[model samples]
Target chain A: MLGYIDKIREIGERLFTDGKVDVVIGFAKGSMPMMNEPMMARSSGDLQKMVWDGNCGINLANYLTNRKEKIGIVAKGCDSRNIVTHIIENKIKRDQLYIIGVPCKGMIDRRAISKAVPGEVTEVIETRDSIRVKGRDFDETFDRGDVLQKNCAVCLHRNPVIYDELVADPVVEQTGIDRYEDVRKIDSLSTEEKWRFFDDLLSPCVRCYACRNACPLCYCPTCFVDESKPQWVGKGIDDIDIKTFHFLRAYHCAGRCTDCGSCERSCPVGINMRVLTKKLEMDCKDLFDWEAGLTLDKRPPLDTYRPDDPNNFIK
Target chain B: MDFMGIERDRLHLSWISSAEATKFIDVVGEVTAAIKALGPNTNFVKNKAKAA
Candidate 1:
């Protein structure tokens, strides 16, 4: 992890000193444990402050939308995928930025570790295989893979699909994993059970919209939630209102979401929102044989339909 | 979804997992009747008509 941090700073310095990019987007040491903040660097002086580790979970590609400056941004597999989606969507021209790709090892789930700790987790130490968590009176160790974010555990792309340079040798992507096993479990449920399952899942939502704001795909000028003339979803905290908001939020991201886990990471209450997106991703893959952000030339599943599209679901 | 504009009843593609096979048939029967009661799709068209 430390070696990667040095490599990232070295690349950031070169990009800044050579005047190849006006701003560099990456991570900096956070003020608290299991946290790293997205940072923007303009000079080698600012580049010196960059850091990288499992805590660099926030996707930096979320900052690329509508920016005109030449950007040198660090991207993990998911971030790079989001970047591909962005270029395809015309949010940022491909030639306008340099991607510093990081071959990712799955990011650790901070909430999982925090929940496991007996006391406040004040310090987190990471090695290649294990994480040693420490606080005032307790110290515990966990296998790195066991504590990975659910999305990372099932991630198909660990290496950036596109990049100008890589900070390290590409990590092997996961294979033979049933990424939709949970979705299948839910799909096996009756309609009423399925509705109850989601209702229970989303009941704890506080309507913070943190998940919406954290998503790279949600760049709508006036998000449906904010529309006044015919407000698509109400502002109150009613149960159906929350469900409607979440339903549309996931629907809007039908074919474009990269399974980046940023939406779930940003939720204040840890809603496990990936269930909704994963269901759509499964549908896209099974019904259309499509994966988002894998290629620039191909259109997303929902963007185009074939005459032979499956019609088995209709009665 | 574009087919909804012409005839909303044109598509209903569902694959029942073997585990849900026994129950999904009943659900499909209910869904078919619900679609019949809903009538033709005019959601976006009505909005455009109102604007015109």
Candidate 2:
């Protein structure tokens, strides 16, 4: 974890000093326990505040969309992939970026840790292999690998597919992960059971739009929910409206989302929003044999077509 | 659902797991050839997209 911080600081300082970029987006130690706030450093002096750890789960690529200035970003595998997606979708130019890549083992699950703790956690300390969480009354230690975020646990693309330079040697990517086990479990349910599954799954939503805002892929002049002309979804906390919002948001990210897990991480209420996106990811993998953001030159599955693409799902 | 039937080509699906490592290369090769045959996707683009 300290190695990541050192590498990030070194790269950040050089990029800021060399005038390679106007901003270097990285993570800073958050005031709150188990949170790493995203920081935008404009000068080399500001790199002092930058830190890298498991809490650096928010995708820095989220800050890159629609920006005109050149950017230097500390990119994990998923973040770098989203950068590739941004380039392909014309949201940002590849030349405008200086990507310092980190091969990730997967971020620690803060929610899992909170659940594991007997009391409210006041502070937390992490290493490459273990995390120690301290509460007002108690402290507990656990192996880091045991509590990784669900998406991170199943990540196959752990190495940055694109990078300007490396922070460390790329880690071995996880394979045979059976990423869609949960998706398949839900798929086996009856139609009504599936409806109830999502209805119950989305019940705690407060309509904060944090999920949409956190996704690097969701850049539009006006989001569909805010459109007043036709008003596709109601503004109030209507259940149907909430369902509509989630459905359309996930649909919009089809073939584009790198599954960075930012949307899920940003939600105040712990909704497993990846369930929606992962279904599309699985379908894309099954039918088109494609994954998003793996290469700079190839277009996304939806943006391109095949003459003899899979017709099994079609009528 | 939007891209069903011959329209299904517009919504391509692929399922090459990493466990089948050698099969992945061959699968990607085939998909590439087919998509190249179909060329760039203009079927779903709108006039608004062109202006943007």
Candidate 3:
């Protein structure tokens, strides 16, 4: 994974020197371990700050919304999909983007490592298949597959769906993976059990909108949670209000969500909000035979109406 | 809604013309029965005491 940084810098340099793009967006090593932050390199000198690794989990496409400048962005499989989503939604023009695609090999779940280790992790070293974590009092090695973020573990699209430049050859996409196993487990639960499941799942949320802010698709100027005209939801952290916020947010992304796992990653409380979105994603695939952001041409199922559209929900 | 444990019958959507009063009445009856069978919606209802 570390080897990709040199190639990323090489591409950023060419894009800057050739005057093809005004800025190159990529990741830089964060102050702490497992916290790579997005960095926008404006010149060849700035390219040295760019880095890539399993820690580059935050979706870079969130920064691309409504931008007017010609941008050269580093995109993983999910980020590239979101770029396609942005173009389809007219958030940014396709011609203005110089996509630098990176074949992803899943991002590390820092929380899992934190749980496994005895102390705060100060450094994380990644090789092809092993992760070495070092902390104040202890050091440990873990297989990469065991600590991958849940979405990446079952990700079927490791190769970017669209790109102008490839950092390396596309990695083999995972096949025969049951992406919706957890969703199916929840689906089989009784009504009361399901209600309690989400209640417990979301009880820790402090109404911090990190999940909403991290999602590339949630580009609304005034999110429903903040609107006070009719006061759709209460300001306090009431149970119903929290449920309303999550439920409506999931509904909004029914067909548009790409299962990027940004929401889950950004949540301070570590709530797996992906369960709600993944349920909707499963429904979209089962009913409409559609996946989000695979192509630039086709409109999302929710965006267009057809005579054969499924109305099974209607009484 | 059903996935989140809201009873599937709690919300109903249908198309009926203004002229079709009979169809409207039938749909309303169905909706009423569905909700009545599920009892009061205790899961999502805001707790008045907590809010106050």
Candidate 4:
């Protein structure tokens, strides 16, 4: 924990002193325990406010797309993958970014914690050893392993695969395990059942566009849904409109979504947006042996075409 | 109506997932036949009578 703090401070100071970066985008301690709000540090004095712990789940690389300034940011395993995708897409130049990579053991899902403790969770105490949750009723202690994200359970890489400076020692080599068991269960349903599931899941969407806003990959200047003149999608939560929004987003993110789990995290009604992206990822791999955000030099499968490309659907 | 020369009501296409294989193919086949029956792209008439 100290190692990461020191590394972050050191890099922040260096960047500020050298004028390499104008602002440092990282995590800061939130008012609540085990919560990290995305901090934008401008000067060396603001660097003192930075904090990294078990709860820094929000990917900061998502902010890099529209900004034109020289910025330094903390990148975790999944975060770095999104950065890599940005580099590949030419959204942000690598030289403009000071990627301070941090190793992650997945972030805690606060909803899961609240479920376990109910109304007792008054405050949280996060440290290197364990997170102590204090409630009005009684205080409860949860091992870091218990409340962490499901992705972290079978995570192969606890360390960032790419970084400008290493903040901590390499933990272990991550094993390549498919993280789609839930998706598979959902996929096994009959066509009508699947349609019903999707319809029911999206029934609560108010067309607020929060999912699109929170998504890092959804950086299009004018989203198809937002175009008024052509109006690709209507404003109402009709069956066709809702389905179009999901399908369009999934297609746009094909061979691009890093599975950072932000879309689902940011959804207000808890839509399982990961299902669409994961299915697309699996299809891309199966059809083209292509994985998203792994390489900067390689073109995404959709952008390139081969004469011998497999067309299984063709009669 | 006239939307940048290519009509709005006649700009017909449906987006479906591969998981909806049977329905997807069925819908596409039906939509394509309907569009063919509607004739060329310029023949798009605004169905304003049914407008909400």
The best candidate by DockQ is 3
Of 2 and 3, the candidate ranking higher by lDDT: 3
User: For every model shown, what is its TM-score relative to the native structure?
Assistant: 0.86, 0.85, 0.98, 0.82
Per residue, candidate 2 scores C-alpha lDDT tens digits across A21-131 of 999999898888878999999998888998888888998888998899999988999999999998888889999999999889889889999999888989888876899
Each candidate's interface RMSD? 11.3, 10.9, 1.1, 14.4
Candidate 3 stretches greater than 4 Å from native: B49-52
DockQ-superior candidate, 3 or 4: 3
What tens-digit string does per-residue lDDT give for candidate 4 at A32-124? Answer: 765578899999999999988777877787889967899998888888888888888888998898889887767887767877886857788
Q: Tens-digit lDDT track for model 2 on B1-52?
A: 3211022243456666779887778766766777777676542222232232
Q: Candidate 2, which segments miss by more than 4 Å at Cα?
A: A311-315, B1-52
lDDT of 4 at B5: 25
The Cα RMSD of model 2 versus the native structure comes to 11.5
Residue A19 displacement in candidate 3 (angstroms): 0.7
DockQ-sorted candidate list, best first? 3, 1, 4, 2
The TM-scores of chain A alone, one per candidate, are 0.97, 0.97, 0.99, 0.92
Model 1 global lDDT (CA atoms, 0 to 1): 0.85
The segments of candidate 4 whose C-alpha lies over 4 angstroms from its true place after superposition are A1-3, A154-158, B1-52
lDDT values of the candidates? 0.85, 0.83, 0.92, 0.75
lDDT of 1 at A169: 92
lDDT for A179 (candidate 1): 95
Q: Could you tell me how far off, in angstroms, the CA of residue A204 lies in candidate 2 after the best superposition?
A: 0.5
| Tens digit of per-residue lDDT, candidate 1, span A109-205 | 9999999988899999998889999999999999999999989999999899999999999988789999999988887775446666777898899
TM-score of predicted structure 4 = 0.82
